[model samples]
Target: MASIFSKIIDGEIPGQLLWTDAVCGVLLDIEPLTPGHALVVPRAEIDHWLDLPGETLAHLMDVAARVGRAQQEVFAAARVGMIIQGFEVPHAHLHVFPANSASDFELSRRSSRTPEQLAQDADALRAALRTQSDGAHVPGEA
Candidate 1:
């Protein structure tokens, strides 16, 4: 069975994507701990982060770091946090979100966002990412 992440990756389900490349894509989480919360996921379906090839892991983090910067630009948060707890979904993913405080890290703080909201947020984030020094340019401007 394809994981939900895989479905999103395959466009079998909708996603508010901020970045997309050969290795991975970054998208806003419908349920976000913060307004700019995003997920960096490998295009390939790998259940555990540790199981990914070293190069793939490196590329994922590199992209996550770029996305983190974009989140900072769009949200103006004090910091951007990264979490890789793979228990929630079968596919490995990196959660990149804005954090004003440690409490912003809690999953319980997540709130549902409408598709329109997510799309708007993704648009802003993609614009921010494009302006950053090392940020990626997603096709269709994300």
Candidate 2:
């Protein structure tokens, strides 16, 4: 069976996508630790981050760094946090979010966002990405 992340990447379900490239996609988390929390997931349904090819792993990190930069700018975050906790979803993914302090890293602190709020957050991050050097990876951009 396909993992939920694969379903989202394949468009079987809706995702508030911020960036999409041949290798991976970056999208806002429905359950976010902060206003701009997002996920950097590879297009392939790799079950563990450790099992991914070196090139794919590098690409995911590159994408995460891009999203983190945008998150900092858009959210005015003191720092950007990233984690590779694969317990929640079988498919490997990195959670990237804006952080002000160490406490912001707690996964238990994540909270749900309404569809409207998610859209607003997505719009803000997408706009911020447009101004970034990696802006070309953002969907619907020139």
Candidate 3:
């Protein structure tokens, strides 16, 4: 069975995608800890982060760092956070978000945003990513 993340990646379901590459995709979280919260997920549905090959893991981190940088710049975040909690979905993923304090790491505090808000956030991140680098991996800009 395809994981929800896989479905989103495959366009089986709607997702607020911010970046995409051969290895992984970055998308805004529906239930976000902060306004620019995003997830870095591999295309392969490895259940645990440890199970991923070293090269795949490295690629995911690289993408995550890029997204983190964009999030910080776009949100004026004090700091950026990355967490690997595979319990929510069986697929491996890194939760990257703008963090102002330790409290921002609390998963229970996630808030829901309407589709319109998510689309706006995605657009902002895409625009920021385009200006930050070559943006070869950003969907529309690439």
- Alpha-carbon RMSD of each model: 1.8, 1.3, 1.0
Encode model 1's per-residue lDDT on 1-142: one tens digit a residue: 8888767766789888777778888878889999879999998899999999999999999989988988888889899998899888889999999999999989888899888888888888888887774454474532
> Using TM-score as the measure, which candidate wins?
3
For model 2, residues 24-110, the per-residue Cα lDDT tens digits are 988889999999999999988988999999999999998899889999998999999999989998889999999999999998899
| TM values, all candidates | 0.91, 0.94, 0.96
Clashes of each: 0, 0, 0
Worst 10 residues of 2 by lDDT: 133-142
Candidate 3 positional error at 16, Å? 0.6
Off by over 4 Å in 2: none
Query: Which of 2 and 3 is ahead in TM-score?
Result: 3
What is each predicted model's overall lDDT from 0 to 1?
0.85, 0.89, 0.92
In candidate 1, the residue pairs with backbone N, CA or C atoms under 3 Å apart (3 or more residues apart, or in different chains) clash, namely none
